[model samples]
Target chain A: MMKSRSRWVYMLLMLLIGAFHILPFYLLFTTSFKPIDDLSSKWVLPETWNPDNFKNAWEQANMGSAFINNLVITAISLVFVVILGALAGYPLARVQTRLNKWVYNLFVSAMVVPPLTILVPLYKLVADLGGMNTYWAVILLHVTFQLPLSIFLFTGFIQTIPRELEEAAMVDGASRLGLFFRIIFPLLKPITATVMILTGIGVWNDYQFSVFFLQSSESQTLTVALSTFFSQYVSNVGWVAAGSLLSALPPIVLFLFLQKYFIRGLASGAVKG
Target chain B: MEVGGVLNREKQTERLAGMVGRNKRLHPSAWLNLLYVPALVLFAVFILYPFFKGIQVSFTNWDGYSQTFSWIGLDNYRRMINDPNIGTVIENTLIYGVCSTVFQNIIGLAYALLLNQSVKGRGIVRTIVYLPVIVSPLIMGYIWYFFFQLQGGALNDVVQLFGNQPVNFLDDPKWNVWIITFVNTYQYVGIAMVIYMAGLQSISKEYYEAAELDGASGRQRFWHITLPLLMPAITVNIVLNLIGGLKLFDVIMALTKGGPGYASQSISTMMFKVYFASQDAGYAAALGNLMFVLISVFSLVALTYLRRREVA
Candidate 1:
């Protein structure tokens, strides 16, 4: 309900916000594409797009092995996070017993426990358990930290499925386990997508936990590898930018394609807080 | 329709809750609750156990390695209090937590409001704003590094256009913390915008129309109708941002490495350096406890305060 003149100001503001948000990425793109010797300002695209930085980054960053580690950790962590979160959510959502309610509160409260607060002991524990630099160790850590949000979301979504769906099946002597597997789990698809995206992104992008726990060269994730690489070669801005760009590509691509789900997942997950 | 949908969801929840009460005894196989055992086991081992262990370690003189370290009684915490950098570290953390929350909410709400209107290309703008949230904060730091790298930074590029001296935005202690907060806000403000947009959308149009009928101006409607109803979203953003910001590590580590002589260290990064660089595990654990206490107290207070003001 604005006049045309005011609408112009409104649109201008929108443009500015858009430009401001994209500026870093734009600068990143130009930097990543430029060669080490190219001394042009970050604003200017190289006269000739050079593949050398990307090639050098791929080699020096140890990206191939790091990619594999990240994939394995993220993939296993996602599976466990989803299954365990969904299972934990079921009775917590449906039963609502005193113990279940307490358990649910435990999961929710765990959300506030910043993982780093326990970093000292967590690292020690994992090290004592001989879990450092192993896939399962980091995987379990990710699953543990991620379960709270997943449980919260799963519980909320399941509660909305009317009780009759289960009760009616139970009257026909459908076993409780049978009921969940046959009737309920399928309906959890939407929330599973949300959980996967939320937790998946988290595990994939995690640096705080991964940097310490996944320390070895063989076990390093993208962030860990890139951090080590970047620090060692801080003078090589083009290489660092390229490595960063390479590391960022998959999530950015996934987000672009699954834009709706990504935004909805973030809003629903956080607003329920 | 919005009211009805919310009411229906609430009623369904209420009815499901009622069923839980009614069927408490009807259902014999309560073993279904055992489904959560696997998850609880992970939590117990990874989270619960380590939490207590962190507290225990805080009281020790462990050097983060070696077989034996003596018990120290509150010595580590006393050291934390006496540590010259502790005050600056804590101050940096609060600035990170509070400043980011404030600016993110303000800017995020503004973006949400603008995009909520009938504008062309707003969809793309919203997508662009949210894109950074998905990228790794470590990567996001490097992306900004190219722009703040002192020698050939983009900020300096723009500075030279104005015939000014090139500035190293990241290296300066005065600007680094604020710049880190800015990057953090930029990365996460999208989430805030989405939450507020959801909050704004859920406010019934009738309230606005009723206020309009009373000749209320835009500002009045926003202050009266919108702000109060949006309190829940505000509470969520504040608590979430506070916690997230307080525990910030990646972006700072990537950008400054808590550098220029611990000048830009938050508690999280500071604790990291203490443990790894200084090999003071006991002090690190104490710092961790302090951070835990800091975050929990801040978020709980904000939650309680905001919850009281919530209209619903």
Candidate 2:
């Protein structure tokens, strides 16, 4: 009897906690569809559901352009980060050279240092290179910051792959590059997915780097654009809520679809440290 | 016949190597070096070079523009030390960091322990809990700001149900920092919970079974077996939260803007304002350097202490 009662208590507590987590999203979603007059009240559901807010938000806030810019930057940066990380990580994992070991250590230690410290100087450097307001500037910065962690993940993963496979391939008359492309890279699919999602979400949602590097309205990423939109339309709660939901959709959808890999990636990345 | 063929192939490869010369023998590692160039060049230009440049810029009176600026020899640091707002900024930062870290861990661990049980809808519940973690903190801040706004806000409406007067959660100086900290905790507790759940799932069931066999109560089991075994997760969560809290910018920017008379100003937000708004680039660099040192020290100390407690 006591056990059953305690189980009920646990269920109730979990439900409440779940509610707390879901409330903001619910509020955002429901309130986005709310008419302007219905926004100021505590009522969650709209008196009349209105889907026009999304259209209004997209056009007025320039979220369409912002969304496309974010997509382009994130996709490009993810490709580079994953490719470069795997390329660097494979050698560091397999090779026994002192240089490889030193580079691996450099990547690991770099993870602990916060990036904001270098913000000012990095901006200046990009400006000097005439990279200001360019997608390449943001993309390169994203690749740089994402590389350390991606390389870390890749190296750890590649180390687990047996050395015997490479030897067998080599004995079969495969060149060094051929062996990697045929044998090693295919085995990296899981870690590559993890790296893609982990870094993809980060670059997609990044505010600080985008704010500094991509200052022009044409180049602004979703988060930066949404923030500017919010300040401008602060009085229009329904419209702003719609914009927030729109900004949040890609990541939330990605997380839902790749839930298993996302959790596994975070767990592996965190505990190994 | 196959063995002889393999031996002949090895000899043939030796001949090929001889033809290719010693340069060809060094080809693999050299190829690896070529693979490493892109990442190396990017890091040098964007991360490492800027870090050193930031250090250099902190000593000069560079207005973030102009080709000619003289080194002021620690003038920025001197001004930073004497700035009256520095004291409040430090206090607010520590409070924000310490409170958010503690609450996130506590609530996160509590949720993890609860969800570790066999329950209906566990997967869905877990998904819901972790939803906020993927959303941008800047957006999360804006969403929560509605709840804390003075008039027609969610929290104020809740207070009205109990016949209490509405409180200005964000406008009040004393309450603003705490509100911002709570918002941060709300967004991040999901990450902490997910990490702790991983840690909890990793704990062997044998420990619990043995404790039960020994007639250990649930409380005792949790205290002895669970807490010690969870040290690794605890360490990771704490270090992440501390570093994140120390360098928090976006949420504060979206929510309070470190406002109501700089009462809730953190180091990063203060640095941004000083650099851009006040046009004090040198002093801002100094502030950034100071923050870097503080974060490094805090991370080192926390990692060392917590990692020591993690069981082998």
Candidate 3:
């Protein structure tokens, strides 16, 4: 085939694929803008756009509180995962010991195991520890699950950082802490960016853990809140659609801001590494 | 030979001396070992503890709340063996998992190849195509369910335009499985696409050019060069999808709740029902244990055998 024709063919195929991807979002966006009276109508295009649904859904869902709760939990989880993950990864990557190797395997193996397998017992354990219905409880759970993946990825990335830099730092009488904080950590910006974006998306979107762990409305994240909305009013397409669009906005914004790093991180996590 | 032996002896002695000096200087590493204590303790308390506690709680006649119950060892596991509901759930989970994994990978690979072609607007398409994968599955469930709503569903509406009967994709067990698989593929194909695209990008164009020089056609080039080169990504995608399919809960929970008489439930969903909703903590633990074993065995087998084929 000629180059020009191939380009057209490729763009056409991509447009078809884009249609599948865009349709659901289009449905969601359009439905969210529908008037309450026209909510049931399957209009391909909204006859009249209604912005009131957003205000109503936000007020009814108390999404302001949910948004705050989600921010707190995700921010805390991301901070810990990045800081501790880097710390843990540095030594685990540099230290050549039998125990560290075993620990590395243990962490990697945790990835394949489903969180649901341990959910019931985890509920009991948290209740016993008086952590139920608390933001910290959900935050802690998120950190635990996210740690292994971050630590593994960081360790792999850290391996590619040459030891000569650290050796030179040591020659300058820099302490191990100094060498890490000053040299290694700064060198890990790309990997750190990758981890932040990757884990950020995950913690933000997590529902199973958030739903099961967070008991009260006060501590609910966007996903669990949206899920509970579905159960309470299954037929209210306007409210559901409005709530979904609101819930999707933050993550979509996040992905857009970090699109380059997001793709890089995903490539490493899913393909490169 | 004598000179080589003498050099080796000198090197060995030097290595020992360096190790001793390093050991004396690295006393802080022993203290640094305590760094893992927090993570390890958290893992044990949250993950390991819950895993084992489920086993202990399962063998009891406890109602999940009270602190007073007697041991009923082997009873819950025994009951599960004869529970006919468990059979249907197992069948549903396996079929859903296998079908989704196989087809998701195929579709994802196809998209990856298409996206890899040098074309204008590729970046925008990649961004748009990935939008679905990033959405929460429960939300996707609601959206897709609307599109499958018999009379008014977009799917049916389109089908009707072609003069066909509207199918209830989410109601019938047979159709529900297909619908569930479709949703999973829709949600995950983007991930597979991105990963496969990364794999594709890693391959040098020189290989394709060389293949073309030898009079190889598109199909032949793909068969001889692309598939083998993409094996690493294939294994990764397959394992991820398999594990993901097996553990799927939100979509199934949101869409059907293992409904139409337990026709769409997965092992994970079954565990949820028995443990939380149905109040069978002990039996649920047994199911959880079964999942643990199944996942571990499959992962280990894949890592040991399949991963060996990836190029270093």
Which candidate achieves the best TM-score against the true structure?
Answer: 1
Return the TM-score for candidate 3, rounded to 2 decimals: 0.93
lDDT tens digits, residue span B1-312, model 2: 685566456535644654232342453344556677788888888888888889999999988877888999989999988999999998888877888999999999998889988988778888998888899989999899777777767788889879999998888887899888998899889889989999999999999999999999989999899999999999999999998898888899988889876889999889888888887777888888888998889888999999999889
Per residue, candidate 1 scores C-alpha lDDT tens digits across A213-263 of 988898999999999999899888889989999999999999999999998
Residue A112 C-alpha lDDT in model 1: 95
Docking class of 2: medium
Instruction: Order the numbered candidates by TM-score, best leading.
Output: 1, 2, 3
Better of 2 and 3 by lDDT: 2
**Ranked candidates (DockQ, high to low):** 1, 2, 3
Q: Which ten residues in a row have the lowest lDDT in candidate 2 chain A?
A: A35-44
Q: Please give the ranking of all candidate structures by lDDT, highest first, separated by commas.
A: 1, 2, 3
Comparison by DockQ, 2 against 3, better one = 2
Q: How many backbone overlaps does candidate 3 show?
A: 1
Candidate 3's error at A145, in angstroms? 0.7
Candidate of highest DockQ: 1
Instruction: Show model 1 residue runs off by greater than 4 Å.
Output: B1-29
TM-score of chain A of each: 0.98, 0.96, 0.96
